[model samples]
Target: MSTVTVVNRLEIRFADLKKAGRGALVTYTMAGDPDHETALAIMKGLPAAGADVIELGMPFSDPMADGPAIQLAAQRSLAAGGSLSRTLDTLRAFRETDHSTPVVLMGYYNPIYARGVDRFAAEAAAAGADGLIIVDLPPEEAPELTEHLNAHGIHLIFLTAPTTDARRLPAVLAQAGGFLYYVSITGITGTASADEAAVKDAVAALRKSTDLPIAVGFGIKTPAQAAAFARIGDAAVVGSAVVQTLADSLDEVRAATEKTVPAVLGFVATLAEGVRAARR
Candidate 1:
């Protein structure tokens, strides 16, 4: 086990939520979507709009787990010159003003691998990333990046799908830090609606093995859905729905950029309200 020296932002944020007796509202957006400046504006505004945590998607050409919304967002990001280097630069810039809100980089592993695991970990920590969620990196192959990330005080967040059985749960929980992201639905992102009863049962089962906070994502589109998940888990993660909002608001690259920030923030505030009101 790697010892974490620095105070992790995720731990702090979740602790604050526990103290407040409210679930967290975690939002996700692709880095440099539409355009770099617009995406940065959205990122900076998220915390103020009631986002407890932010997951910035590092654009990759082949995102297997992502659905059309996130895939399109990645395309737009790459088209606008979003790269691993650019993503870190955006994080560094965001850190200048908002140093408290936990930010996690979520995407596939190829980009990180191409950058070299050790170097990517070092750069990510230097750029103020609090954690990472590599969709394709299984626990068996995660040590390469986890060791480096853990050493730098950056958490390597893991995902547990509906298909993850009891026998496989331990392995996933072993490498998980910051939080465990539960894929609410069995398939790809943003396609199906999560079954509330199933999610409740899954969270209950997961709690028996690990004390880490569990955040449910995928198929969570509405505030009602987010509230339901929040009541069941420690936090609710909203991604594809928010990304779809960006897609709908875009006119062109620059015009869409102008509309994306406010539109996404407004939607996030509603989701936050739902999460905060859960169990109250």
Candidate 2:
């Protein structure tokens, strides 16, 4: 684990991950995925490959925003005996050697309710998690959850989709603590295209709501696609593509991640470097 550095805001952590001279390859995976014990192996493999941050997915029986690929991954992870307690333990184990990489838990709210918010927040914070991304409970419905996480000094990151209009941006930003996560594409996750012009527009709109660093995700796979996102948002997140990689073949997953983690993040890292270089 890297030394714990005092950070004023979660965006700083995101910025640090981007320091690899690439955009952030924010990979998502169910905690007890493929096999639960193998999760740490997967996590350990990611940082070296190119993953700046990890979206440590807490697998729920039902994932609303998720399409088939992620839903299946959740089932496998659950069947493998993955649970929030074990997931927290996995992260606790991770902190024994890896302290610097930012980890955010993304999932729905039902499991959280089942687990009890206070207990969840306490364990998550104690285990060294950086933040949370609850998909179903939008800002208006998030007071109880966000309040608890905030009280424990954990960030509750929110999703801002392309369809999020001006009226919605403020509400999203108000509930958002970490970096503002912008969903570059709409509908389910894992759809991709180079039409980032709309992404840039969303970024601009989000900028009006908050000065927080913006990390865009949804259907972002490959280095070229990552670069496009980094040009517009502060960071970019890659989910289902990598999840699919892991689901298809763990070896292929690692190989593919080795290619993408560095590939995508390297693109963002260069952008981060450029931003730093420009000041010189």
Candidate 3:
């Protein structure tokens, strides 16, 4: 078998951010939202708009952990013919113009399982994806997929929630790569707000266990909220609010309008400013 050596852009990005003395701004968007062309435009524009890392959400019919905004985004994407292959294509296209920005594929596991772990891993690696955030795939049950991704030098990023106590944390951190995503809230994504004090305590506790970068996500809506969480963690991830911006810009039929791409990118720029200035 031929071995492929990966550059590990995620790790390099984190190290660079650390040197700059600021937190990274991570943005999430559904691939093929409204339409493939508009979604690609937004993806291409993200890095210039100040996003440090891009989390390209893979559309799934049953995104249980996601709230209404993301669920609606997935619905719109699926209607526009979004699939695993198409999502990879989007990443590949984004890589054509911009290569340094780290991109993580975030979503559920069913689609990856349907495509087979090895094939999915190979395709993702070839497409310039830096990491993965499979929400439904717990570490205990992820060995098979993890193995395939490891062989390709792709990081299988894991999520830790507010309830991830001392006992459960070791298991979560053992196989985790790239970064540890800390779900600031307990329930589904974007429904409630993330308590700053609770998240500060949680991130402090997490630092005792692992040296991996912690990215705070879920319930972070505005620039101030992103700035607060970014100060607590190494990075800040914003999803539902970003998705909602895209959704709102769509036409009455849920189709992409002239405002779709610009609106999403503009909002991300504001959040990026918050994250960039957080530690300074």
Candidate 4:
């Protein structure tokens, strides 16, 4: 496929959701959390469970931006032999059956850096990754990775926050594509709730800066919060909460139980309901 076609998948998804009169429900999960097979199962069921986009986490030892739930999830996945290659393989498998739902690889920069940016970009593109959210990479230092990603038709999704000032906002949006991720809270993921009024104003300001669909993440835990964010932003991303659900469903030995996949998908369904109900 052409690079344009590969890259436009994200734009196409958001456009479809906009026409449907609702925000996209972007669900996040660690690639091999609990175990490889179970994680793949949960990923495959996400679209039917009401996810418009899937943020497949690339597990790292030090996920400084995430909270306890996601940190533990990364640990579990790594312990089960989760690696960048394995994560890409899982995506390739998922693509065998589904092609439409956009998948963004979300993680820190260490793994990608070690894997070689150009090679990683090529592999990610071939594996059906539509975008990437490298939490630690700033726009200034992103040229090397951004160049390769752009060549492969992958979006370098950048994160903006409540702390992003007028001067800093321009740089963040400079090379951002697919969608802009808005970190609702200043701290870390899954800690504290987002203030609705603040988010509304923040998104409004972002809209004036760029037309890229803004996805609000961090601090979104429940269906109510998802619905609230859906009304304000182009997409609502729920990560740590979903990870926590999966963790809760795991067996005593930290292996996947019968309820693992279903529990996560069921929670996603409820959140999707809230998001879909927003504009209706």
Top candidate when judged by lDDT against the true structure: 4
lDDT for each of the candidates?
0.91, 0.72, 0.93, 0.94
Compose the digit string of candidate 4's lDDT tens values, residues 75-188: 999999999999999999999999898999999999999999999999999999999999999999999999999888899999998888998999998999999999999999
Relative to the true structure, candidate 1 has a C-alpha RMSD (angstroms) of: 1.9
In what order do the candidates fall by lDDT, top score first?
A: 4, 3, 1, 2
- Count clashing residue pairs per candidate: 0, 14, 0, 0
85-199 per-residue lDDT for model 3 (tens digits): 9999999999999889999999999999999899999899999999999999998998989999999888999999988789989999989999999999999988899999999
The segments of candidate 4 whose C-alpha lies over 4 angstroms from its true place after superposition are 1-7
Task: Compare candidates 2 and 4 on lDDT and give the better one.
Answer: 4
Top candidate, metric TM-score:
3
lDDT of 2 by residue, 104-185 (tens): 8888888889999999987888888888999998999999998778767788898888777877778888878878888777
69: Cα error in model 2, Å: 1.6
- Residue pairs with backbone overlap in model 1: none
Per-candidate TM equals 0.97, 0.84, 0.98, 0.98
Tens-place lDDT per residue, model 1, 1-280, is: 5555787899999998998987888999999887788889999999988999999999999999989999999999998899999999889999999989999999999999999999999899989999999999999999988989978999999999999999999999898999999999988888999999999999999999999999999979999999889889999999999999989898854347456778999999999888888863
lDDT, model 4: 0.94
